[model samples]
Structures are given as C-alpha cells and as structure tokens.
Target: MLSTVLLRQLTDQVQELHTTAESQLQPLPLPVLNFKPTPGSWSALECLEHLNRYSRFYNAELTTALHAQPQTATPHEVGFSWLGRKSYDTVRPDNGKKHRTITHMNPAGSQLGTEALHEFLQHQKCLLEMLAAAQGTNLNRKAVRIEFFKLLKLRVGEALQFVVAHEQRHLQQALRAAHQATTAPILVV
Candidate 1:
C-alpha cells in the first residue's frame, strides 16, 4: 500500500474508534461498565483497561521510533514483513477466534473505574498524533521493537497496523459487554 494511503486509512480507523467510544461506551454507567456476561468474562471497563495497558507500551515505542527517523517524504509503498502480516492478521477484529491474553496484559478481575474509559480515549488521541507524525517517515523501515519479543522489530507501518487491529479487537469485546449489561434482564431477590 502507498505509505500515505496506509497512514490515512489507519488514521480514519482510529478516529472512528474514538468516536465509537465517545458515543457508545463513555456514557455508560459504572454498573454497566463493570458487567460481565459470565464470571470468567471481562467487563467493559476491564476490556478498556487492557487496551490502555497496551497503549502505554506502544505509544511510547512509536514515539521513540518516529523521532529516530529523519524527516522525509512519505515512502511510495508500505510493505508488510512476514512477521508483521501474521501479527496483524491474528488480531483483526473480524478474526473471531479467541486468543489467550498474555499474563501481564490481562485486566480481568481488576477494580477498573470510569477512568479506564477516559484513558482509552486519551490513548486514541496519542495514537492519532503518532500516525500523523509517521506520515513523513519511511513506513517500511524497521522502527518499533515488538513488546513481547523485544528481539524482533516491526516496520513502522506494521506496528501501527498491529496496534490499531489489537485495539479494534478489544474495543468490540467491550462494546458487546456494554450491550449485554444494558439489555440483560434484571434479577430480583
């Protein structure tokens, strides 16, 4: 994909995600945000917290990587490395298959509050800024080191795509939890 095209697409996705959070998720009450479909399932707040954890890591890494590159025109093409493709494919929101969360990334059972939602919104803003900063840099250049496997590095474009995909995956989970909370029948003792 052309570097500009890729960045533009990712930027749009981030903006839409932000809008969804504001429109559909932010106004939810605390009880609904904390509702879980099942005991083992994450609540809406927990899902956002999980995304917050990841954003803390990735936003910083992206900043460092973008700063290291000299300013230049956007590259003609943003090619995905094999590892990059696999990483992004695994997290695409439509994948539907469940993947185990890494231990540290799991936010299950945490006493998350409304601030989790606020933090996620802030993170999305940071991501939008990073994407804008990335436009003049070469997307194919290896920039960000993978969070889990630090030895492996992803191209700037790859890292951006993976982050956005991962966010989308969790955001959908959060939305579902919120919907269930709002629609589920109340129990009376």
Candidate 2:
C-alpha cells in the first residue's frame, strides 16, 4: 500500500505538472507551439505527443493496478530496485543533457493542432486521478509492465515517479522550444 506521505508528495507533483501544462502550453499561438529549434529537435507539440505516448501506457497500467486489488489504510514505504532508481534519475529534467528518444516514444514531425494540448491535458488529469486512486494501493509490491521492454517491470510507485519526472523533462523541453522560437514571440511565462 502507498504511504500517506508518498501519496501527498506525488499528488503535489502531479498538480504542479497540470498547472504548468495549462499555463505554459495551452495559451501558445499555433506557430509558436509548433516551433522546433532544429530539424531533428521536437516542437512543443511533439514533446507533448511524446509524453502522450508514454502516458497512454502508464495510465492503462495504473488503472489496472488500482482495480487489481483492494486498498488498505495501512501504508507501505516505497523503495526502488537499483535499476529502477537509476532509470528514474536518468529521466529527471536536466537541460544540460539530452537523451535520445526510443523510436516508440519519438513523435513524428507531423503538424499537430491544438487538439494535441487537449489530449495532453486529458492525460495529466488521468494521472492525477490515478495518483489519488493509488493512495492505499500496494505501489512497491505491485509491478507495472513497461511498454519499452516486455520483460521489464517497475513497481507502481516507481513507475509514477518515472512518469512524472519524464513529463517534467519533456515539458521543460517544450517550454524551451516555445522560448527559442524565432518566428513567434515567447509564449512561456
């Protein structure tokens, strides 16, 4: 089961993510939203699309985990395996370092309209709901399958941390893209 402290921390992070997405991303003009620093880099929309891809997998896993068993009032402390901890650290936002995206998570350069932001917002809301539902759920013991690797699994709490951190990283990338646009005024404030 998830501890009250961990759940509160996770909820706060999710709330911050939602607020950032709404304020920084949703109000941008289309051209600015779509601006990419270079041919190879992702635009704000693409960054969000990339996040949507991961969220699709995670939200499903979280929903399943929530319904998989009954929750308890007794809280369990969250811990991660060495590999999981390392993976979580690596995904955290650090503008100085850029990691190559796996093919599956990479967004195509296709033009995404405002609907992309709406979808991303929806995903964020789902994540918040999942976090709340996970309050008394066994986050450490219950494994959620990773989409990238069939055999790899992260405990529920670890997965939540990774997903939230990954969102922050990409959101930073998106905000950077917005700020760096030459064709449009900065939309991030």
Candidate 3:
C-alpha cells in the first residue's frame, strides 16, 4: 500500500509526462514524425512505437496485478527494492547514460506513420487510468515481475514509477528525434 502523498506525486508526474508528450508529438506531420537522424537512430515515430510496445505490456500486467491483490486494512507507503530503485533511476532522463534495449522492446523498423503517435497517446491514457485504479489498492504488495527477469518482482508502486520514468526518457528521445528531423539538411537524389 502506498501513501496517499506518494500516489498523488506519482499521478502528478504521469499527467505532466502525458501532457508534454502529447503537446510535442501530436502536432507533427507524418514526414517529420518518421524522420530518423541517421540509419542507426530511431525516428520520432519509432520512439513512440517502442514506448507503445512497453506500455501495452505494463498496462496489462499492472491491471492483472492490481486485480489479484486484495485491499489491505492498514496500507503503508513502501519504497522500492534496491533493484527496482536502481532500475527506476536508470531510466530517468537526467541519467545521461544510454543503455541498450532488449531486442523485444525495440521498435520493428522505420517508415512508421502518425498512427504510432495515436497509439502512444492511447497508452498514456491507459497509464493514467492505471494510476487512478491504484489509489485504492495495495501498491506495496509484490504485484508485478520485471519483464526481463521473471524471477524478480517489484512492488506495484515501484513498477508504476519505473514505467513512468521510462516513458519520460523516451518522450525526450522522441522530441529530440523530431527536432533533428526538422533541422536536418536534405539532399536531392
């Protein structure tokens, strides 16, 4: 069970992230959304697609986890485990470290369309819904396992925070991709 204060804080962060991502990515044209800085880099659409994939997994997992746990009489605010805390810190945009993503989490390819943006926004909506659902649940219970390591589990609150931070990191990536796309020099074939 998470403290009301913590839940409020997390909710605020998720809302802010959703607003920023929507404002930045929702208005772009298809060409700009799909532009990659280079062959190896992700385009803005690719970034959103990658995030959407993770969001799909986490949203479902969180829903199931929330359903499985019963409400507790005395809910306390529990912090993350060491591993969970480390994982959450790693995904923050300020970390400045680029980690390699698991193959499954990577976007399929470039040439994506604005529908990716729509899906991304929908995922954000799901996240907000999940956050709202969590208010009455025991967020300190071991609810969800890490996607990469099924052996390890995180408290529900920790998992939500980690997911939000990951979203923030990728939103920053998408914004950077969009910025690069708009500024890049074009060459006629």
Candidate 4:
C-alpha cells in the first residue's frame, strides 16, 4: 500500500464517518431497541455499537504502532485473519436476522452500549492525529508481527488499509441498520 493512497482513503473514510455519524446516527429516535425487529437482530444502534468497538481497537493499535517506532522509516502494519474477515463482511442483517458482532470478535465482549460511540469518535480522532503527524519511515515501515493476528507480518501501508477498510465495512453495516430503523413501521397508540 502507498502512503498517498492510504491518506486519500483514510481522508475519505473520515469524511464519510463524520457524515454518517452526524447525519445518519443522530436522526434515529430514542430507544434504538424499539426499532429492532427481532430479539436476535441488531438495531441501527447496535451497528454503531459494533463500529465503535472496531474503531477503538484499531485506534489503540495504530497509536501503539506509531509510537513504538516513531523514528523508523517503516510504518508498522496490522492484519486481520480470515475468521476476522468473515465476521467483518458488509452484511446488513434484516430485522429478522440478528445483527450481532460475528463470532471471532464477539468476545470483543467489551461494553457494547451507547457510550461506545463517543469513545470511538475520540479514539478515531486520535488515529487521525497520528496519521497527520506520520512521516516517511512511519508511513512506509512494516511490522514484523501484527499483534492482533499474532502471526502475520505486514507493512504500515497495509495496516492503514485495514483500519480504513474496517471502518468502511462497519459503516456500511451501520447504514443498513439506520435504514432499518427509519423504514420500520410502528403501531402508534
């Protein structure tokens, strides 16, 4: 992956994320669960929940990688596995289908609630900060072992790709959830 391309993609993702969160996430009415169609399915809120989780994880990883080798010309890299990949697909579960985080990350099992959005946004902003300060070595260097995967070696460029791609993947899912929330009908009293 190239830095210029990576920056472009990240920039796009950031802008899209801002738009999605500001425009799509907010118009949602309160009690997101109300819009949910089934017990197992995720409401639009849940999609945001998952995105928050995913973003936090990458934010930490990106910060660590950049800090660990601030002077290196090679930017550190991170990679997700096939299992992670499967869980990360852009699937917008209908209200009938449950919209839970896939198995590999479920035990992601952290706090999956409304507050997650705020936390995610903060961390994502931090990631953007680091990205801005990022320079020659940081952008180009590769990591010997991507800690998350535990056994993969990747370039810094690929790591950035993963971060943006992961967000985009979840963003799509969030959009689906939002659509469901808005279009679903309710029985008014």
Choose the strongest candidate by TM-score: 1
What lDDT does model 2 reach? 0.83
Any runs in candidate 2 off by more than 4 Å, and if so which?
A: 182-189
lDDT by residue for model 3 (35-84), tens: 87888889888888888888888888898998887655245766778888
Q: Write the per-residue lDDT of candidate 2 for residues 40-153, one digit (tens) a residue.
A: 999999999999988888889878877887787477778887767877888888636778888877886777988888998899889888877877788776578878785888
Top lDDT: which candidate number?
1
Stretches of model 4 off by over 4 angstroms after superposition:
37-39, 70-104, 107-113, 138-140, 144-148, 185-189
Candidate 1: segments with Cα more than 4 A from true spot = 186-189
By summed lDDT, the worst window of 10 consecutive residues in model 1 runs over 69-78
lDDT of each: 0.92, 0.83, 0.81, 0.57
lDDT tens digits, residue span 38-136, model 4: 655555556566666656566666666677774645433434445334433423222234454556454232334556556556656776776676654
Q: Clash pairs of candidate 3?
A: 1-140
Question: What does candidate 4 score on TM?
Answer: 0.68
Show the colliding residue pairs in model 4. 41-98, 42-99, 73-137, 74-141, 75-138, 75-140, 75-141, 105-108
Q: Give the lDDT of residue 23 in candidate 3.
A: 86
**RMSD in order of candidates:** 1.8, 3.7, 2.7, 5.6
Task: Please say which candidate is ahead in lDDT: 1 or 2.
Answer: 1
TM-score of each: 0.96, 0.90, 0.90, 0.68
